[model samples]
Target: MSTAPSVTDRPRRGRRPAAQLVGIALAYFMVLLDTTVLAVAEPSIMISLHTGVAGVGWATTAYTTALASALVLGGGLADRLGAYPVFVVGVVGFGAASVACALSPALAYLLVFRALLGLFAAAIIPSSLALIAALYPDPGARGRAISAWAAISGAAMAAGPVVGGWLIAVDDWHAVFVINAPTALAVLVLCRTPITTTRRLRALSWLPHLGLAATLTTGTLAITRAGHRSWPEAVLFGLVALGLAYGTAAVDRTSSAPLVPASLRRDRAVWTAFAWGAAVNYALTTVLFSVPLLLHATATAAGATLLPMTLLVALNPPATGRLVAAHGPLRPIRMGFVAFPVGLALVAAGTAAHGRPLVLGLGLLLCGLGVSWTLPALVGFAVQHAAPDAAGSVGGILNATRQAGATVAAAVAGAVLTQDRGSGTAAVPFLIAAAVCALGLAGATTRHLSRTKEAPVADHVAEARHLGHMSRTSDGSSGELPGD
Candidate 1:
């Protein structure tokens, strides 16, 4: 029995001690930058393409759905093919698609190109993290690298909107897409090492998986029939998510080289962190999309121009990183839930008082800061808790859940707004956000509570050692470094 314990409790493989952190950082920057850049360019795209709201929205939808579909596969592909190969392919493919998107003259062409871009972008997150783990074997170094990754990602997201806006103002929607090509090309140029390739590619074809993904994407797209929020449609989408999720689970279980590693799904901590992140994302997307609209509508209704209302939409990404990094992620996540409702309340009050952009902007900033904290922390936690080989799978799952939540929120909130126009109606989404956040907050609190009673005696010894090390390291002239 003791020998059995040792066999089963063996430590998993960790990241290698040496990998180029700079390459990984650059790749992630491109991926995250792409994630948010399109939002600011939407108005310009619509006008230039002569597209309706539905037409323009497909740009986002196609990207997201394609990303979701590719993500699971991307992880498995990484294991078989190699992280570097997958990442390079993703970058080159994404860059090509970006150029296509930029050059496209029609809305249909743009959608197609954007979907193509999504396919490549899907690999960047999981593959990058997997590479990080494969490269950095030491837990402390790996953790620091991941933190640095999170910091870069957060900073990119913060910067994307303004950069996107600038691109739109200076040129056209094409500029947004054009910008990606150079960045991606640069990433490829800098990382010249041949990435690993998967044996899975030779072992089996991807047709079945691709078919399953197609079905899910088709069904998800069908839900955008904004006026068709009937029971039948809801049931249809539910069945689609259910069917695809089931097929994925089944195939993954049976396949020798499954897209999501079987070991990854079994971890309680990973699942919990992923769920929390997804729920928060669902709430945040609703808020991010809604607040700007609310502010613009209010301003327009009050006979004011909406040019200044752009400030509210602009508030979020700028300071998200600094705030989240300053405090440990959990506290910020907790604060985010609290701050969300408070921000909404301020917006509600401000709208009622007068359509003041300043108050609205301030409110949006608070909400943004709150999300910044939660997101990176969630990413870090998910990656850390997952098995080493499964980093890509876990990251994909985490991102997939987050995007799924966002997709659902967009549909549901859009429906609500379509049906009603009242202060109370606006409050409904915020209330739902607050409730979802409360659940996440409760989960966080429970984690803390559970940890409290599991205190190890060695923790005291470790703390004393750490303190001594820190004391020695610190010459009374500088603060102790993290993990000291």
Candidate 2:
């Protein structure tokens, strides 16, 4: 087990290591940009591939389903392997996959490569955060870095449409995939810093992992088919999906080595965070998927339309940093639960009211506020409370829920809006999103109220407390850096 350094031995910890932080942030930025940029590009993809909405929906489903399915396993890998090596492999593999995607000749080829992208992405996501945990061993430093890292997502969120539009204008749908290649290389170079090596003999259950992946993928396909109004196919796939989920759970129940650790399975905060994450991404993915399609927007026009919401995404983090410093993480999260539903409802109203720009813009603004307020804070909250060695595992689980939300929203939006591509159908998704957020709000509030102590308070105080608590871990390893 590691212990904190003495006052004399304490590392300066004055500032975040910029190169590593930027590399970590940029890796996630590329991932988010890929998602956001592709939202507008979906129309272009449909046109280029000579496919209808359902085909386009499958393309997205293939990637997100692969991601959600593989993340927990990825987390385990990050623990067994060192974070740095796992992260490097992910970056290299992601770049190669991006190149393969750019070269694909048909939708089938593209779908295969897209799944590869998600697979490599699974490696990157958990390990990158674990790298952050190692890089900033001080909870105080790590919290700020985590916030900054998450905030950078707003830049990607904001840029996705504009960048996608610009690239589409310059070439076509392939440019979006091609851009990732260079970005991946840059991440590799920037993230070359040597840090602590954390390894664990974490148990991995492949059968359960495969079962969960199948469950999500088949369920997604069910939603995709149901969106096209193929009730028979939907029912078949849905039943299969349910069967897979049940089987996976049963296997997990009896397994000597469960896919997820029992400690994580028993954590109330983790479960609540999972639900909350799902709610946030459901609203987000719905908007990203539907608006451009319903409005019949070109890339540039879609960028302008989404700007109001995306801009708010960028603006929220810095303020959230201060808000987190003062009022604590829960306030922003509560505020977000309120803002998300209202914004979604307004977006639904705007879509129903003849695609009114004013209403849509206002609604998007609220959605942005909701995202900015909640997501970074949530990241900080989860990471702050976790055991250092389990950082990757926690990151994986939290992101798995978030990605699961994205996958479900994409499927739901595809099913709902793809059916008609009409203003009426557009309103249905936002309405549904609002209801989901309301449930999240209720759950989160209930959790806060039931707890006796506001233990997950501001990072500075929490960090000090955590340092005192885990100065030496069970393994008796030092949670310290060379100097810092």
Candidate 3:
């Protein structure tokens, strides 16, 4: 077994440790909470907005698309500027947009503002991860911090429904989003100390990234509108296809600052990690978005109450996440891989049985557990292998994969689930999720996770030998202890 660097001499200085973790964690919690609350409130939004399936779907997709497209830029900008200021901007902007979403009079207005929210919210994850990377310079400490970070996010996902449900039950659907404002403001108030930092120009171009976003946006619109007979729909589909093709070409030609970093693209471990992370997020988002709708649709169709269905869907996230932490990411992820299909099968069986809420909830819980398990591991792997100077770039790419993957999944699942206009559509998304989880499992079994233990400990010396790679490759240069 390769030994890690000596623990006593790792770099651990310049920032208050608890402050870094607390500030970043609070920021992350708000993001996760917003996503979860929105997921459960989808049914309420559709009813309140008097919109069709497309309108409800856009509520989630808008945030994800904006978030994914902006993440890399957010990270690079943070590096160029400073994390604290950028982070505060993201917080205040997201909080302000939450108000916009809450007070909007029309679906269009809400979506426009939601997109704005996503743009600013995009800064949070990359900034938080980069801050953590800067603050905790030791690998072991960083890993543990990430694990805690993941745990907090998982907890938030679990709590989303309870809070959303309470608000939707007692107050209004808009209140679900409105709650973010005060919480974010409080976090911002606490984070007033600005760290002095300068922005660095990344070698990559933004055109390819823009192309990638255009591809996803257009592709979603194409898939969603596939059933329409209108000439406008056809034009949209054609445009989407063109954008996808253009994005593909752009990625192939660019070596510097492509949507995906060259390091991630070139490294199998990193690339595989990216693919798995995308797949997991895609499946998770599909479930989060679709399951509530399925339950409500079933309850409404059958003239049953909505409470039972809501409760069951709500339980899956936190419950499964806690299970994942206990069992380790692999077992839960594998189980999630296996369990997702089981949940889907239950959904299929339940839908066939005319909206059995218990079965549906059980299925969702299984899927949620699987997602929580897989996501942390993928994130952990990406951060673990990143080159020192490239932490922001790596974090951005990984987060982009997550947001984009979830966006794609949400789009495809929406397309699939909206077809029948019945609760049976629930089975469609569940099936797709099952397929995604299976793909994740197949990828997991490949050499990636197993190879982690065997990676060279002499990587620091090897990295030092490479051109332009000599600055602080590993710990021990600053006389600070690891895990301090």
Candidate 4:
């Protein structure tokens, strides 16, 4: 018998399933909105706080690094404690952290509170998805629900800059953080309804969690210091991170319940999806980070420029879901990979041409379309390929990789921009992003094409079996023949 509980088994005492989904989506929206809003408000923050570019960059870096480091542990906690409870706690904590961040008197305090925000955010992400999965038991409905979730996130990302810029213009950067309080409170109220809970899994080993945290934190710090610090120091950080990563793998191997279970670690599809997530975000963050500095634009202008891109990102995923349902994920994913580099190249050209508005606009549009095409499919594939009971873990790992990519992007972009705060320097990061997109494209084409070729053969076999046809062998046993 299947161990998974039926959806109908639970009593419907609280909110309806649709209400639950909205509540979860709102919580997720708050997290994504905060990230994008900060991107727009970052320049204002530097001015208000009397900090350097690198210091302002650390605000984002610290939060994302903490988030990436704690994701696996957060997912494990969700699976053990139940998604509803974990999600409620995360929402309350995130709200408190936002209040603390708004009240921060210094840059150091802001960074600390931002890191706290990330720690709680890690709890919200995976559990939100797990809760959605629990709420919608039907596979097809679940897919649609996930598409909606992605759409909500895309909308929040698009709105963040617009909202943040307006707040900064009207009041101050702190208002951006202050706004999160009400939204989080609304989520808390909506989520007060009871939901079904999952069976608690065995507690995960702590060593692997520590190793993963050390590896990501040190690795991000190493990248952040590149071009700003001595090579020897950067190398030491890198080496230490590498050693920690290796140790994490060793611990994973020895542990009964590893942080990243072998089933997921060994799955090619899962890792490929993770890589795609990382690469796409790396490119996206690089663009979001460098464009405002290059144009010497106001927070409002910066947000407006990015608005088209993020809006497209929001609108494209529902269409992408339709495409995935009809043609499978490979085509759209490959198309996205190809378009991403082209878009970056365009943006680079535009930036080099003294921030030409038309060129930059076109480039951002393409980048948005590219991400919209790929991200839903990538996430869907990751979830589909995960072990049945390990959805939370897989969600955590996927998000962790994406955050790590963002962390690297912010660090590298900060380093590049620090050296030359001119519009010309913006092209450098865009070119680098294009190269990363090309790498993702190459991997997608090579692996997905091989899978595509084999698909027809598998289809033919399935058709023959459906037809109740089999070939007789010399030993008188009937079996499926080659190309049957």
Highest lDDT against the true fold, candidate: 4
Using all chains and alpha carbons, the TM-scores for the candidates as numbered come to 0.71, 0.84, 0.77, 0.86
Q: Candidate 2 vs candidate 4: which has greater TM-score?
A: 4
lDDT of candidate 2? 0.72
lDDT per residue for candidate 3 within 1-484, as digits (tens), equals: 0112222222233446666566667777777778767766777787788986667777778888888777767766665555657888889998899999999899999989988888888776556665666666667676667556545544454466667777777667888788889878777655555543334444435766577667777877886776343458957676866868576656746635556544455667667767776776776676667666765542222212223323332334334334433443344456656766676677666654654668765665565455544554444445446655444355456666777777877777666666664755557776777787788788767776665553333442222111111001000001111122
- Residue-pair clashes per prediction, in order, are 14, 11, 4, 0
Error of 2 at 148 (Å): 5.7
- Give RMSD (Å) of candidate 4 vs. truth: 9.1
Please report, in order, the local distance difference test score of every candidate based on alpha carbons.
0.56, 0.72, 0.61, 0.72
Model 4 agreement with the true structure over 28-146: per-residue lDDT tens digits: 88887888888888888888899877777788788887787777777667667677788898899999999999998899999999998988987887677677767776666766776
* Candidate 4: stretches off by over 4 Å: 1-20, 133-153, 383-392, 447-484
Better of 3 and 4 by lDDT: 4
Q: After superposition, how far is residue 478 of candidate 4 from its true place, in Å?
A: 44
What are the per-residue Cα lDDT tens digits for candidate 1 across 330-360?
4555666676666656555554444566776
